[model samples]
Target: MARSLLAGHRLQHELESAVDIVSRASRMAREIQKRYCDATQTVGDATTLAKADASPVTIADLAVQALILGELHMLFPEDRFVAEETSSSVQDERMEGAIRTWLTQYSTRGVDERVRDSIDLGSDAGGCRGRIWVLDPVDGTKGFLRNQQFCIALALLVDGLAELGVLGCPNLSAAQEAERIASGYTEGIEGEKCLTIVNGTDGCVFFAARGAGAYMQSLTDRREQALPQQIHVNANTDPSWAVMAESVESGHSSHSLTGKMIRILGIRQRLGVDSQCKYGLLSRGEACVFLRFPRPGYVENIWDHAAGTVVLTEAGGRVTDALGGELDFSHGRKLPNVRGIVATNGHMHPAVLAAVKHVLAEDVTSG
Candidate 1:
């Protein structure tokens, strides 16, 4: 009985620590966003090089990874991490120096060598054995370059099951702020529908722990009355009335296939977005369905979806593979056992899964 009580206490402490660490990391990421968005810095300045798979890595990505890993190391020295970015991508001496400079700006104790090591610490191969922290420092680099939707996603897994998740959406408007502003405008104005504010500078931070539900709060510097408010998935069950959120890049997920599935499911509106912010939107009841059917031979990284999966599930939503299999994260960095992903508000998951299966099978036979 004593051991049980101690374990519970440890879990609570870890969850709280994770929330604080991710929030600080999010703030650092927003500073990078402001620099790029305001024309003070260019995309070329932030982008260093592409990975072997041709995905771009920017200064923000490497810097955020270093910041988060550095903090986690100080907080939980024994914990392991799996992240997307690596220091090797920053081959240019100037770029590497720039990253170190930003590290000092964001964190208090930034040792040059130690910070570089922290960025490389993400290469650890994670398994289902012990506590593993997963991170995608900058989930959608392209979207971020365009000053569009993106996120900094983080999650903690115990024995391969997600225990905690946090996401920072720098371009997302606070739901409460949105509603408050919307309330002031009269309904019958000429551009009333277009007047809705969808994005803001302060942005939002979403966090969730297993069985504790999900909550969102403002990601701002002001010491305002920022209390976490519970959020959930939309209650819409009818397919015809549902909206689908998908990736903006076709290569990430087959847009043609998604369109076909959307047609089959009779979903009327489709929102093309970037990064895990789609999951954030779904968790906050903005969208009813989120779909991603990667090309036939593509494998997904656990960091890309781990945080979003936990956040959505805790917000009364459901997540699964294209064939409705639970995502298996025990196989190191990549989700080798899972193929494509499908997320919804749990109301239309069955119908959506059936439609996905039917569409994919038809495509297979036709090809």
Candidate 2:
């Protein structure tokens, strides 16, 4: 009994520390967006470049990563980390200076070495043996640039299974969302209308522990709502009335395949957004399903879905590959074993899985 109590205490302490670190990182990202990503600009004024995979990397990505990893190092120096952004992505002197400027907001350490070391802390190769912290400093950069939906995702994996997850959706309005849900406005609501009507504000932080359920709080809440409102997936079991959520970027997922699956399942309402905010929406029962069938040969990164997966599952939702395989995150930083991603409120997961297989099988036969 003593051992069990001690273990529970330790888990609670770790979760509290994680929430603090992620909240600080989220605030820093919001500041950067306000400064650089205004209405006049599509992409933030921050310097941008392409990675080896041809994906966009911006100053906020590096800065938020540095802030989160740096804080984690201070809190738990022994833990390993895997993240998406790297110091090498910052090439020019001006960009380096921009990163340095952001670093000063978080710490008083030396600018040059601090920035590089903090970002490089994420270079560790993760495996199934010990504790690892996975981070996506800024997921959905295109959404961030356009001032749309984007998130700062963080997760802790113990022995390769996600035990804690935190996501900061800068465009999500928690108070408004609760009001909408309470009013039974779950269908035929435009995504933009949801954003504008509910608080006209951005910023919500959702988090979960392995066994404990998922919960959310507003970033702008100065008083820190004493107890976060617990969240759960929708209870609707009928497939015909389900609402689907997918990425707004067609390049990230196969639109044709998703369309076919939607039709097959008789889903009529669809919401499109950028980032793992889809997972946030699902957790709060704002959407019933999330489907992402990445293009052929595109491997899903662990950081992209790890935090979101835990958040959804803890909120009475289920996530797996399109073929119903568990997402394998033990190999390294990438989910080499996952072919595609599917998420839904628990009730409809099996039905959704059937539709996924049917659509893919049709593709195989037609090809």
Candidate 3:
């Protein structure tokens, strides 16, 4: 009996270990976030570089990416990584200075070939296969630079599906703060510029596996004592009653198309947020639906929504391509097959699908 009990306990421990990986990722995100928040304490200030593509690269993005990659390498050695940054960004004299300075403050692990490769791998432009990790490092660079709502996004993909997702939204609050969360200020606090934790208090972290149900936690707290609340989509099919989340950055999605969809659905209020926090909101039942319809020819990356998909699914929500098919991440790095994605509380998913199809059909007829 004693041996059997020990074996059972060990089995439970392994099961919990998989769950603990989410916390480990979250912990790293928070640590990097703290460093980033500290380095950029001044508002309207930043260290910038011009990538070859001319897109802006800030110290905050570099520092945080380095921090996360360093931790990932240590934690999962055999795991492959598909990332967003390339070493070339750090090689440019202009970018090199910024990279060295920013990383100096945030990276306790000195830069090495592995770190360089991690950045380079992100810029590698290779397709995904087998088991791989996809990282946005920082999803909303503009938001991060502007000190608006941004997030560090990480996802683990296995056989083309996101098995795990971890999003660190530093600026969100758990407390009900009016219509929009104030910029620079987190939730729970009345008003303060200092760094505040929303995880245990008002801000939440969402996680889920394929079939294991979704769970939410306060960013600052990670105790198993409290059971995670399961969530489901609203059964209300009335489009007028729907509350939805939209992208704050128009470039990340198609605002015009989103507006049209919203109008068609007759949703009265449309909320905007940065990063995967939209998934967090949906999981908690704060919002009923979320949509990401990017421009034509631009495919959405798996890293951006993989983890969130599992979390929402586990929470009784449904996620799929805009055409109502399941998201397929296995083919390659970019989700090439799907043009858009729709996420909703399970109850409203079919209705949402019908509404989307109706609108598209009408557009075809009108054209």
Candidate 4:
């Protein structure tokens, strides 16, 4: 009897542990977004010079990452973190002093060192066998610099599968704002003076855990809504009529080749965006398909897709690697050891898979 009681308690504890990690990740993202809001006030504007990688690194990313790492440590100290950016980039003789001095103005004392090291973890390439946290402190660096869309993408991988993901999109407006922005109907905006879409004037956050459903929420307390209305992709199966989202930056993906395939399938409307916003859009039923087909042998880091994949899947979408293998985040820091990614509302997934298989077949025959 005592053994049975202990087993039940242990199972319950594990289940709660999963939920807590995912929930805290969402909270951490929200905290980071809030910190970004505060940092931008002091940084003047996000128009900083580019890094050697030609990517932008504003005070926003620095502050937010530090805040997130601190939160992760507080919430789950034992988990490993694999993130983007590193102290080395910030510490460059050309940039370190300026970066450090600038960060001091807005950040707490501890934040300086925390940001430096966490980013280094992002640059390092090891640790995937155990539980880990995959983080893209700021996924769309260019977008963030341009004052456009970007996301704080986070996911939790146990063993090798991603069991939870949380995405913070600070610029997204709520449903009410979305409607007003689309219709040009903003007589008395309720929330803060942020972007307004047809939905609402608040920022958007996406969260999902395996087995649990995906949900979206307004980052601000504008209308005090619960979250995004549960979303999924469109059901149209005719390939030609499909609409898809491709990386706005061609360098991040093989846009020309993806376009060729889109053209081949006769897909007409293609939307270009950054980060996991495509996944969020897909979940909301705004877009039906998203394709990230980079070079033939390119591998994607887990942070780029972990949260977005789980969110889309929980929302009733399907995501797979380019070769149609499952994207098992359980494997570690990188994804299921494959190239590229594809996500769609499940209705058109089979067709997409068939098309991809056909393309690979053609490539092989040509080879």
**lDDT string, candidate 4, 97-165, tens digits:** 444444444333244354566445444343547667777777776555444467777777766677666
Give per-model TM-scores.
Answer: 0.88, 0.88, 0.75, 0.73
- Arrange candidates, best TM-score first: 2, 1, 3, 4
lDDT of 3 by residue, 171-256 (tens): 66543332443333222222222121232233444555556555554554535433444445456667666766757666777655
Q: What lDDT score goes with residue 294 in model 1?
A: 80
Candidate models: Cα lDDT each = 0.78, 0.78, 0.59, 0.60
Please write out the lDDT profile of model 1 over residues 244-270, one tens digit for every residue: 877867778876787788778777566
User: Order of all candidates by lDDT, from best down to worst?
Assistant: 2, 1, 4, 3
Clashing pairs in 1: none
Model 3 stretches astray by more than 4 angstroms: 1-46, 52-54, 91-114, 121-129, 176-202, 221-235, 364-367
How badly does each model clash, as a count of residue pairs? 0, 1, 13, 27
Off by over 4 Å in 1: 1-10, 37-42, 108-113, 176-198
- Name the 10 consecutive residues with the lowest summed lDDT in model 1: 186-195
Distance (Å) between predicted and true CA of 148, model 3? 2.2
Quality of model 2 by C-alpha lDDT = 0.78
Cα-based RMSD of the predictions, in order?
Answer: 5.9, 4.8, 7.0, 8.3
